[model samples]
Target: MNARRGPAWTNSITSTVRRVLAPLAGSGRGIFGTAALLLLLIASGYIGWAKWGDIIVRRPQYVLTADCIEITPQPPWIHSDIKSAVMRDGSLAELSVLDPDLTKRVVQAFELNPWVAEALSAVKRAGKTAPRVTVQLRYREPVIMVRTRDPRWKGDCFWPVDTEGVFLPPEEFSSTQTKAFLRVEAGNSLPAGAVGTSYGDAGVTGAALVAAALKPVWSSMGLEWIIVRQELPNDVGQPMEPTYILLPAGAPVDAVAARRSGRLVSLADPPADEPSLEVRWGHAPGREAPGEASAAEKVARLHQYVAANGRLDQLPPTTVVDLRPGAAGTAVATGRPAQTR
Candidate 1:
């Protein structure tokens, strides 16, 4: 070993050259490395194509944007509806696949109704490449329905409740508009939507009882704005402050009264704290109370007493003929005109 130290640097260079050229000299392993890399690249491409191949089929789907939200009472033409508003726009046609935007346009129009409380629109697609779309609409119910005298409605009556029976939104009308609709029918003159529902009329009911039932409704309409409507319009509100109409003694006497009030108070009334219908009624003009009596009996007696003694014309500001007991609805008595019932 001590004798070999003289040529150490030259030997080290010779050893490095042999090691560096060893693979090129005769090893076949380099070809195996190239093959491994080629296989890796091929595997990656196959896996990627397998996972994402269906993306092209899903790309062309339809969508709907409406009212920026969902709505109710969807129109008949629209596919989405809350309750009865939902309907099928297709009628044995593959139209959605041919044209998606057309379906969206029709539904949009239905959503535009002022009565609609809310509206939602979206596109629905079917099939792989060419998708078909469908639409939907919702609507608002405006009138209150009551018993009808018609044969078709059977025995059920409708109450004029909104689609949800909640009050309508204030934005639907002007500040000056105050309208209340109450309907009872035995005929087919008005549409079901206008009156709140489609129902048959009740035939041959008593007159006074019907009047009593409708009395509350009529009173409510007149007092809606806390304004006095002398009379309802001939078709709506028209006359002075709200008035209590005298019935013509018919089956729907209360209805007639209601109609008159609606016409008289066509516009919102002036502010008033006390409700007009709640005003007190007094006993007829004269005849002192002989003794204690029940409310019903007292009313009957007062009618007799006024017929015999009191001259109603003699009373002041006695617009109504109060036949109610304890003079509950009697007008003021004046010393003049001779009180005759």
Candidate 2:
């Protein structure tokens, strides 16, 4: 080495370089071995988790049992069992709390029930021995009753509907229950549909809105029937639509008599001399024709009359009240009491 050295600085630089690389000399195999081991360890871990991940997550604490699912308090009108209805088909069987779609699945399950108008939220309470799911819901409330002439049911029968004209479970209404709500007489054109389904009739939907609006004063006003004119008036045209008339009670309505007698009494037209009053409610709320006052204005006009003359029944018989705008006070006339078929 001494004889081959060209310069002292070059020798010194070579020595320094050799010392720096001394520990790494012959360690290539070791580095390669360590890398291979690390890769093997990583692959094994992945494989192990892949094989047993489901089992680990399926533990008692991670499972969402039927009993653990909770629903928010429901209104008195909701007669159906929400939980039973939602899970009747076992749609959420074996669902896990850690499921990526847990909230979505729970919401979908609740939406299937006719009573649930909307699923507000679905929250999970995890980290417990039994994880829990809490669901917030909005339910449909029966606002009006629809008297249907369906051939399937004998005698007088009525179907309850929500404000949106969505059919409710008719069986939920008892005779006493039926009397508590306003009723609409949609003629033979009333088509049948499943629960939670709309009647698809503009008249029925309109009637529902009117009924809801009248519910506060229904009893005080002595109102009975919401007669949906099957035959649209010949005068019905632009700025004018089919009419909905509010008739005061005590006009010898057969439906009323049938319920009283508990018998199937045939519907017949009332006597020509029967004492009655007719309130011409133009159209559905927010659906007023051109030149017609808003629904609120019409309602205010109606309330004004009732306040002045007491209930509709207290008014003179055959009195006609037009709540439309620009109409004067109630007009007295003579006509047959409209029949509610």
Strongest candidate by lDDT: 2
Per-residue lDDT tens digits of candidate 2, residues 1-341? Answer: 56665545445545655564555555676776566556655665576557766887788767776787889877887776778768765477677787878989999888878788899999888635666789999888888777766567786787888888888888888877887788777664354678878977777888888888887787787787776643333444433344576777665443422322221111233422444566767677877767666666666777876765667766656566667543444332233234310
For candidate 2, report its TM-score: 0.72
TM-score of 1: 0.26
**Alpha-carbon local distance difference test for all models:** 0.34, 0.69
lDDT of 1 at 113: 39
lDDT, residue 227, candidate 2: 64
| Model 1 lDDT at residue 36 | 53
Root-mean-square deviation (CA) per prediction: 21.9, 13.8
Per-residue alpha-carbon lDDT of candidate 1 for residues 220-305, written as tens digits (9 for 90 to 100): 22212111123224546453222222211122323333333333331133312321221112111222133323334433443553
* Positional deviation of residue 298's Cα in model 1 after best superposition, in angstroms: 34
Model 1 off-target regions past 4 Å?
1-93, 97-138, 151-156, 159-189, 192-341
